[model samples]
Target chain A: MSRRTTLLTALGWLALAAALLGLAPALLSDFRLGLLAKYCCYAIAAVGIGLAWGRGGMLVLGQGLYFGLGGYAMAMHLKLTDAGPGQVPDFMVLYAGGEMPVWWEPFRSPVVTLLAILLLPVLVATVLGAAIFKRRVKGAYFAILSQALTAAFAILLIGQVKTTGGFNGLNNFQSFFGYSLYDPVNKRMLYFLAAGVLLASVALMAQLHRSRFGELLVATRDAEERVRFLGHDPANVKLVAYVLAAVLASVGGALFVPVVGIISPEDVGVGASIALVAGVALGGRASLFGPALGALLVGYAETSLSESFPGSWSYFQGGLFVVVVLLLPGGLAQALSALASVRHRVGGPPGGRRRRERPASDRTRPGPTTPQEVTA
Target chain B: MSVPGRDYLEVRGIRVEFDGFVAVDGVDLTLLQGQVHFLIGPNGAGKTTLVDALTGLVRATGLASYDNQNLLDRPSHAIVRLGIGRTFQTATVFEELTVLQNLDIAGGVHRRARSLLRRRRGVPERVHETLATIGLTEQADRPAGVLSHGQKQWLEIGMLLVQDARVMLLDEPVAGMSAEERRETGELLHRIGQERTIVVIEHDMDFVRDFADVVTVMSAGRVLAHGTVEEIRADPEVQRVYLGHTVEGVA
Candidate 1:
């Protein structure tokens, strides 16, 4: 991109970060801040959905599996930590006769829990994605397979009630890395941490969108056969995007556990996975900021609407999603673009020249990669 | 067309069958380096099927080799990585991506890693050169879906150019092009053929006659004739099977 455009984009990102980091804390109460933190975690997962479904064209309907992986991983460590050094977790004592499952033993160490949070989802996605994509599974079949996986994962977690806390899930956390959760100061800190992580995730996505891998993933999405003819294994391109999305979802889940103080099948099921996708779709799946912002908007709307109309808020949310999708298939981003184009039309001929002349300068000139040229 | 014993591509006994019906049955072909070869046939003559078999897009039992490496049974993308590039009968540019981005992806496909941290430096010199070559430099920033049918065709061909494949397999490159576009594409193929072996599957007899260095005529899943364009034109069997109803009549 031209230096001016790059500066503008950077400034825009900074403005967003400043608003989130500075304005939010100064304005909101502790309860509201905590809610925003939970929303931020969902937004992080939505960003991953945008990458996989929006750009890579992989309808990852089973992100909950990875999300649950990270959430459960972190939850186990916290539960063990709460139970103290040599004792079984309280849930195990209450439900499983004070016997910790062998699998849960590894999460006793904080370092191991963190690493698992980072690596376990990526590993699962790699194995599953490689197998499915290499065999050339795609379209609705792939979507169904992913959805089924999420359903099965939720079922397995529910069925293992003695060890998994049944449908009640893991909760009642008292500390995070030694900071007592009861302190409002620590709660605010956790909110900042969540915001910071969301910002970092956005920055990471921006970097990937400009990278060659991002371009290849988009290309694969558009035409897998053509990409294959270009000497790229489309499966590999898709697998990378899938695995990246899994890691992002996993990280989001890890953060979710501490922020919400709960990890349950309800939060990691086909319904949750589709809800995540709905947020991305509403935000404009292909856009960088759209998914995150869309998710946050959805979360806000859900909470406020439910507070006002407790029983019927879900119908309102569903109706709004349906209307946005039907009226503007490209989501909020498409609506914004359409508005801009309309303004351009009304504003006169000068705006027209820019679009027309873009190809000449962009094609013939040797210059830096333009952000719009890459991502758009 | 003999220099020494070096063959650019060799195919032996390729056969493709689906549910007890043979599409491409027992075909052997050879391609020479830096030449324009055309494979022409009627609608159901298995010409595209043969290309599919050669490119590993279809299940085929045979021995096929490019640069002394066996190609049979390899995956389609693996075959492409072995320096074979192809275009579909239908124009298949990435519709959402711009013309330049489409070419850029094709150019960057062979790069060692599609890294997250490392941005592609710039549009490669070759990509820009290809835009000019295909006469689409002016439309490079436009989304490929907005391009006209003929423009999309040129863009796909431009993609092949940027891919830098040793062998280019173009399936119906000029199938739906206007007369002027076809003429331009013929010229483009002539220029491109100077560097790489090109196997063009075309229905346009005039294009084949005007531009082909070698013509392989297929009829019902087998080679009816394989010779220079003139030799194929002169052959009675090719005339009866493929060119019999032509106005020009293979004169």
Candidate 2:
């Protein structure tokens, strides 16, 4: 890495730390802070989506499936614990007429719930990835398959009304590990925890992007046949990346439950998956910080818009997406770069010669190609 | 080091059919350890198809074995793990990756549980050595996409070297090369043949005549002749099928 890149990376992390831990709670209201906490969870999922869909060329539209699995797992444990040992949870009686489901028994223990949150999504992704990648089902076929999985997962969860809490979904949790979530201090603590986890996940992703495995993953995505001929199994490499992305999404979902205090089939359905993808696209999918920023901004916009114009928020969101897509194909990051260039042109050395040289060098720098073209 | 009674590659009446159109038909060939075997044929003569079948990129109907192991049922990656490396007719390198990184990926890593937890080690030196051998050491840091056509071919061969497979299958390794580059590549293949079995598919008759220990000529999805260049040159069927139809001064 160059000295300039090193310094920029360090400064970026420092800024992120300050924004999450130092600035968020001080500037926002309690409700807004809670919303930001929810955004952090979304940001986590977006990061995984960016890696799999953007860099690895997987087009994983079903990240919400993993997210839901993790959230429901944690929610089950929380509901069970809140209800105490012998008695059934209140939602069972209210929603399902007092019949406790057999499948929900495993999640009574915190350890089992946590493990399930991490492992279940990975296992599912492994099987799905192996099945699809081995057959060289890629491009539109892969995208459709993954989207179908998401739709199936959501429908399955919705159909399992008794066990999964159904369309209304799992909610009305009173406490999390005896911390009385109604307490503002506990809410703030959850916010901090979300921020901390988001930071760690970003750091981990950054490390992965720089590693040899990352290089191979991108290469496999770009030219599957070439990588295969080079003696590396493209399927296996894609599987690793897919599983990692799934696990990360699951973790994000697990944290999202406590932070947002509810989750539903609707939240993990096909529409939700598309929303996640849109955020990544709007933020610059290949960029390190793009997904996180995009997710947070989208989340914030959703909440504020719903409050300001409850019936028209979706239309506004749709319009915003269109404008962003039209104006910034490379996402907000590229827009920022363009803005910086304009500023430089306005303020820098007077003669147009130096300005002319800038764009020429920029053109020579090789803009990021699509994941498929990257290795071809 | 040729092992006693151990042929590097053994194909017995292998046939590959794509949707009932035979691409490689009943071809029998063997590559002994530490020898350069050349496959020379016209376009669509099943030279690439044969290489594809050997590397498990495409399935074959008949018995195909490598180093005494059954290769007909194995997956392409499993075939690679069983010590077979291959390159495509068109130059295929990781365009985004530097030349060194491309070699490193080709050099298989020890799988410790899942690949996510595994670390790639000791590949840099191997990559460097392969780069030096292929005369690409000065351009090791350059992206593979930007290399000259001849350089890209060398880089790919370097990738095959780093893979450390007992058998290397190269399809048209000197395609699109300048005359000088083709000569250099012929010499490089000669050097690599000492360490591993090399099966090269080429249309260039001069390159095959200069480098091949034995030439397997294919036409119409089958092996037409298998012998020394002079022996193949004297075959009437080969002359009628190939040399007889060729334009003058092409070779």
TM-score of chain B of each: 0.92, 0.91
Clash pairs (backbone) in predicted model 2 = none
Candidate 1 per-residue C-alpha lDDT over B1-251 given as tens digits, one digit per residue, 9 for 90 to 100: 24333348888898999899999889999888778999987777898888888788888998887877788878888888778888888898877678988888887755667343466677789999999999999998877877989899889888888887878888998987898888998999888888788999987778887889999988889988999988998888988875554433344
Per residue, candidate 1 scores C-alpha lDDT tens digits across A1-376 of 3468557657867987998899999999999999999999999899998899888877787899999999999999999889899898888888889988798899989999999998998789999999999999987789899999999999999999889887888999989999998999999998888899899988888878777788787777766777888887889889988998999899999999999999999999987887787788788888788889888988888889889889886687677667665665567877776677567656757647766755454353221122222222
Error of 1 at A45 (Å): 0.7
Error of 2 at A85 (Å): 2.3
DockQ winner: 1
> Candidate 1 docking: what grade?
acceptable
Model 1, global lDDT:
0.83
Q: After TM-score superposition, what is the CA distance of residue B54 in candidate 1 from its true location, in Å?
A: 1.0
| RMSD of candidates 1 onward, in order | 4.5, 3.4
Name the candidate that leads on lDDT.
1
- List DockQ for all candidates: 0.45, 0.35
Q: Per-residue lDDT of A91-148 in model 2, one digit per residue for the tens?
A: 7887778889788888888889989999999888898889998888887778888889
- Runs off by more than 4 Å, candidate 2: A1-7, A320-329, A336-376, B1-7, B110-123, B248-250
